[model samples]
Target chain A: DTAVSQTPKYLVTQMGNDKSIKCEQNLGHDTMYWYKQDSKKFLKIMFSYNNKELIINETVPNRFSPKSPDKAHLNLHINSLELGDSAVYFCASSPTQRGNTGELFFGEGSRLTVL
Target chain B: DQQVKQNSPSLSVQEGRISILNCDYTNSMFDYFLWYKKYPAEGPTFLISISSIKDKNEDGRFTVFLNKSAKHLSLHIVPSQPGDSAVYFCAFGNEKLTFGTGTRLTIIP
Candidate 1:
């Protein structure tokens, strides 16, 4: 089974349009996160969900929203996508083991392009 | 602000030599640090990690050294192989793992 997966591996849309990226993890992890990698290859955390509860939310723009209907899935929706949104979005997950050092297993990443 | 940072954008090392990658973090609350390797068109893979209590951890040819006081960590690949060429990312783990800008490593055969 694929540990982490994302949908729409490549997305290209015009500016001011709306789009969504879906992600799912079969690892049964309690925690999931979203990260953005820019053209410079700098990865930055956007949001994190733990058991359906939002945990960490970086100072991202208001147009971006994350929805986790269940522990196995987390989806990102972008409204009025701008050219700045053209980058790779990655989804990762980790098991809920406190005091245990857990590693984030990332998905292949969804590449979004806004023209 | 970038919490975790890899100063070198790229590094080249010959096969059969040691390749060292350095990372620095400013957050003292980070209790765990990790190294990830990524190839183009693929997700980053967990390489090695170390906790705050341990200063060093080794797995096969990869070794990670952590200095808490200096907030520094290094990944050393001994006898680097040609297949070891990839982008290395260092992360500082808190509620979420903050990644660095990544360092592209090339191994010359």
Candidate 2:
């Protein structure tokens, strides 16, 4: 079973368009996170949610928002996508916010391309 | 500022040899560290981890060593196989996880 899964694996959109990526986890984890991997392969945290409560919000632009409907789902929405928004977005989940194991289960990742 | 940094962009190792990947961090608050491996078209999977309290952790062919004083950590793979070729990332975890730029490992037979 896929512990963490994200939909719209590949998205190609034009500038100024809006898009959303959906993510879900079945590992009974309490924390979920959205991460962006740029072209240089640098993974940076965008947002984190614990039990549907927003916890960590990196210095991401307001144009990007993350919503967690439940403990098991976290979705990312991009408003007025720009070329700089093109990158791979990863969804991850952990058993706890401060996981002693320090391990996260990650989804296959959603690749976004803005022209 | 990037708290975690992997200076090596790529490392090529011959089969049956040891592969050493190094990572450094600037945050002293980060008490937990982890290593993850990712293949093309796939998300990273957890490989091994070490806490600040310990200096080394071993799991089969993978071993992670931590140097708290220098804030340096390294992952060692013994007899690296071709299948071990992938991009490896080192991460520090506190309130949130911070990842270093990945280092791509190529194991040549």
Error in Å for residue A64 of model 1: 0.9
Candidates in order have lDDT scores of 0.93, 0.94
Docking outcome class, model 2: medium
Candidate 2 contains a number of clashing pairs equal to: 0
Candidate 2 per-residue lDDT, tens place, A1-115, comes to 8889999999999999999999999999999999999998889999999999999999999999999999999999999999999999999998988745778899999999999
Write one digit per residue (lDDT tens) for candidate 2, span B1-106. 8889999999999999999999999988877899999999999999999888899999999999999999999999998999999999999987677899989999
**All candidates' TM-scores?**
0.97, 0.98
Which interface RMSD does candidate 2 score?
1.2
Model 2: runs farther than 4 Å from truth? none
